[model samples]
Each structure stands twice: as structure tokens, then as C-alpha cells.
Target: MAVLSEEQSMLRDAARSWVQEKSPVTAFRKMRDSGVDVGYDADAWNEMAEMGWAGVIIPEEYGGSNFGYLSMGLILEETGRTLTASPLLASGLAAASALVLGGSDEQKSEWLPKIADGSVVATLAIDEGPHHRPEKVEARFEGGKITGRKTFVLEGMAANLLVVSAKGPDGIGLYLVRADDGGVKRQRLQLADSRGAANIELNGAAAEPLSGGFELVEKVLDRARAGVAAEMLGAATQAFETTLDYLKTRVQFGQVIGSFQALQHRAAKMFTDLELSRSAVEAALTAIDNDAPDVAELASLAKAKMGDTFHLVSNEMVQMHGGIGMTDAHDAGFYLKRARAAEAAFGNQAYHRDRYARLQGY
Candidate 1:
């Protein structure tokens, strides 16, 4: 198991408590009723920014905490538990990652400050089609102009900026494109999880090229996938815990169902699976943070294994809770929805499994 420093542990506890008190499951229920896609509670978002969560992996020079990836993982896990929908992951983790990994000094200096203060929301638009493969980026860049469409961009509709991937004469590249650019168009896509994302159409949108090329995009995508895996683990952990609580309190057949041998065995298996997923997620996070030689391979492994764990844990959680679990009024369904969405966010289990095998030189 990976250990956190005292301060990191304290920050994690604080984040957990803050989310529980300020943005509980009831809050999510309210957002669901309001027909909001992102479920971004402004007050809650402000509070998180105040606590420096928006800068979890940003540098100090950019008015950020410069905490590092582990701290970012901790915050993401807590957010996952609540099924909180916000631009935090899309902007804070994904966009910020692209900037740090590939942005020029001037770009970082200008953008990181706004991101740290929550004034700006950004997203990485990498998938040019339904297939979600970075290598399949068909967006074109020529003479400082970008032209193409990207789909399934998380927070794409709400983003102030977009880090878009494209194939240029120099090879594949990343470019920063302002959301309000003349030729850029965005249309929201309805996702099962109710998060805000968009299908973006860019017709010769102006762009500023990032410093690094294809390698930089690959690195940032790996980081984003690893982050999503951590978020999935967090969601699975909370789902298991919530289901356990329900089992303890809901009595059936003259006793708590949790006490029944069959359900007990199921819960035990869920726990084991959850722990295994946790270990994989933690390993990926650590490897990415340390720039370990095997980061790519480990990230793929974590995503593949944890994606399966998320599906199994969430499905069984709903099963254990019976009819109420399937109802929209219940919180268990929210967890299951988020699990499904996160599993497919960057890539699904099959996608990661193939990537992992390739990385292993198999």
C-alpha cells in the first residue's frame, strides 16, 4: 500500500468531510431534479477553490499549491464518492495536466493562475470520433489553423478553453484553442451519467501550438486515464461501503440480509475486488507521479482491472439493495451510473486490456 505524508492525509480527510457536509447525496438529488448536466454547485465549487483543490497539481509560481499527483488523486476519490459532477476533473486534472506537460512558459504563466483560482474551466479534446483512440485523431492543423470535430469531450460545453489534438504537417500535435473562437462550435451531448460534455466542430479555428508533439499528448492522456481510474476506485469504495450500510440496517427474513451466508460471501468478494482495484489504482498514481519507467504499462493495467471491478461492484451493489437500488430516487443508482460512465470515459476495459498487452510487448 502507498502511504501519504501527514499533511496529505490531513488534506484528504478534510476534503472527505467537506464534501459530506456541503454537497451530500441530497445535493446530487437536487441537481438531478433541476435537469442540470454538470451538477456543478457554485457554492461548493467556490469552497473547493478556496481550499486550493483547483491547484492540486499546479505549480506554486502559478498561484497553485503545487501539491502533486497523489494529492490530486485524494481529492478526486472524495469527489467520486459523492458522484459530484463538476469541471474539477476535466479542467483541474485533464487540462491542467496538458498545460504542465506541454504548455510553453508563457502559456502556463497565463493559464495556470486562472485555473488555480477557478476562474477558468478547460478540457482536453482528443478523440476526433466515437472510437476514443489518440492515434486516430483526424483533426487537421495547417498554417496555425485547426479544422475538424471532436466528440465526447468532458466539460466541453462549459470550457473556456480547449486543448485540442490534431494531425499537422509536423505530425500529431496539441493546440490550445479558445472556446469563443469564430469557427468553433459546440453542441452538448447527453450522457447517461448526466455530466456536461460536447461534440465540438472546428472549422479553421485559430490555435497556438503547444511545445511538445505527439509524445506530450500521449503522456497527458495516460495521466488523465490514471486519474479516472482513481476516481472509479473511489466510487467503487463508496458504493461498497454504502451497500454494506444498507445491508446492516435493512432486515429481511427475520434478520439483516448481511448476516445471511450467501450475502456475506458476496460482500466478502466485493471487498476483495475493491481492494485489488485500489492497489492497482494506487500503483498507477505512484508510477505517474514518479515518472516511473513502467508508468504506461501500469496505467493500462490499472484501467483495465479497475474498470471491471467497478462494473462488478456497482452491479452487485444494486442487486444487494433490491428494487430500491434501481430507482432514480435512490443514491445507489447514482453510483452505478457514475461507475458505468467512468468506465467508458477515457477507455473501456477491453480498450485498456489491449493497450496493456501491447505495452507488455506480448
Candidate 2:
């Protein structure tokens, strides 16, 4: 486990209290069932912003606390515990990082403050295909216009601004495109996790150039991956705990299932993996904060490890609960769905495993 500063500890505790009391799994179920176009409770997002969570990484001059990556990760972990649905990750962390790292002064002045205060929702519109291949961007930025389609855009339906990756005159570059542009069209996707996503088609929409080339896209993506790994750690931990509770209570052959050696071994394995995953996740987040040269390597390590653990724990959770876990009424199904969706997001275990080895020059 990572050591926490006084403020980070307070922030985590407060987030825990609020999520437990106000935004539990039950609340998530409600939001999902409502079929909200935005895919999150607008009121809950406002409350999170009001608490300064949306600005955890933004500079103080831009109306944010400038806490850094691990600080934001702590809050994300808390939200993952309850399956909270919000644009905080997409807009607050990912898009904000792009601007902070590569945006021009004018661009930062326009978008950073709005993102910090939740006045606007902005997200990265990269990955033109099903998988997260940032290097395969086919989107074109020419003549001050963007043209191409981006698929599986996080918070796409709700974003006011898109930090888009496209091939510019100087190789692949990041551009800012307005969501409401004349040539933009979006189709909402009803994913199993019920999270907000869209397939966006941009046909010569007016675009504003940001800064940096593909390297900026990579730096922003590394931050996003680390943030996702942190969330996976929380979900995997919670799933294991939930399964453990079931094992302790569910009886078979006149004995508690947890007393069975086979089940006990599984539980031990999950506990060990969860602890290890936490270490990798925190290390990745810390590397980002320090701007460590090995951030990509650590980010891939964390994401791949956490993805494997979450996959194992979520599956075990369903199996341990028997028929009840398979039902829609039970919360186990929620964790399973979220685990699969999250595993695919940013990158899956397979994807990161390859990336990690490549980073090490293996």
C-alpha cells in the first residue's frame, strides 16, 4: 500500500463516507435503469465537482487544487467501490491532463476553468476502432477542421469539448473540437455496463490545435491508464470481500463453504493478488506525479496486473454466490459487467502485457 499524506487520507475518507451514504451500488442501479441520456446523475456530478474532486489535477491558477495524479486516484478508488458513474475521470483527469501538459495559453484559459468547476464536460476522443490503439488514429485535422470517426468515446454524449487525436500536417496531433459543431454527429451506444459512450463522426468540423504530437497523446493516455488501474484495484478488492462474505455464510454439506479447503485457497489467492495489484497501481500513479521516465512501463504493469486480478475476482464472485449471483437482482452481476467493461477500457490485460514487454525492450 502507498503511504498517504494527511490531506490525501482526509480526501479518501471523505470520499468513502460520501459514496457509502449517498452513491452506493443502489444509486448506480437507479441511474442505469433510468436510461439517462448523459449516463450519470447530473445532480451527483455537481456534488462531486463542488467537493473539488473534478479539479484534483488542475492547477490552482486554473481554479483547481493541483493535487496531482495519486490524489485523484484515491478519489477514483472510492468511486469504484460504489460503481459511481460520472464524467470526473473522462473530463476532469484525462482532458485536463492534455491541456495542462500541451495546451496553449488560450486553450487552457478557455477549457480548464470550465472543467474544474463542472461548467463543461470534456473528454478524450481517441481510438477510432474497437480497441485502444492511440497510434492508429485515422482522424484528420486539416484546414482548421477535423474529419473522421471516433468510436467508444467516454462520456461522449455529455461532453461539451473533445480533446481529439488526429493526423495533422505534422503527424498525429491533438486538437480541440466542439461537441456541438455543425459537422459532428453522435450515436449513443448501449453498452452492457450502461456507462456513457458514443460513436462520433466528424466531417470537417472546426478544430483548434492544441500542443505536442503523438507523444502528448501517449503521456495523456498513460495518466488515463493509471487512473483506470486504481479504480480496478478498488473494484477487485470489493469483489473479493463480497465473495468472502458469501463463502463465510453460505452452507453446504452441513459446513460453511469458507471452511472448505478449496474455497479457502481461492480466497487466499484473491487476497494476495489484490494486495499486489494495489502496489502496482499506486506505483504507476506515483510515477505520473513524479514525471518518471518509466511511467509507461509502470502504467502498463499496473493496468495489466489489475485487469487480471479484477477478471479473476469478478468471476469468482459470481461462481461463489451460486444461482443468486447469476440473477439480475443481485449486485454480483453489476461487478461482473463492470469488470469486463473496465478491463477493455484503456487496455485489457493482453494489450498491456504486450505493451509492458515492448517498453522493456524484450
Top model by TM-score, which number? 2
Deviating ranges (above 4 Å) for candidate 2: none
Model 2 TM-score is 0.99
After TM-score superposition, what is the CA distance of residue 286 in candidate 1 from its true location, in Å?
1.1
Residue lDDT tens for model 2, 265-342: 999999999999999999999999998999999999999999999999999999999999999999989899989999
Model 1, runs deviating above 4 Å: 37-39
Per-residue CA lDDT of candidate 1, range 1-362, in tens? 57999988998999899889887878877776787655466677788888899898999999888788778888888888887777888888889989998898999998999998988888999987777688887799998999999999998878899999999888898999999999899988887787788999999999999968998888888888888888888889889998999989999979988899999998999899888888888898888889899988888888888899889889988999999988987787888888888888888888989988888888
Candidate 1 residue pairs in backbone clash: none
Task: Evaluate residue 207 in candidate 2 and report its C-alpha lDDT on the 0 to 100 scale.
Answer: 93
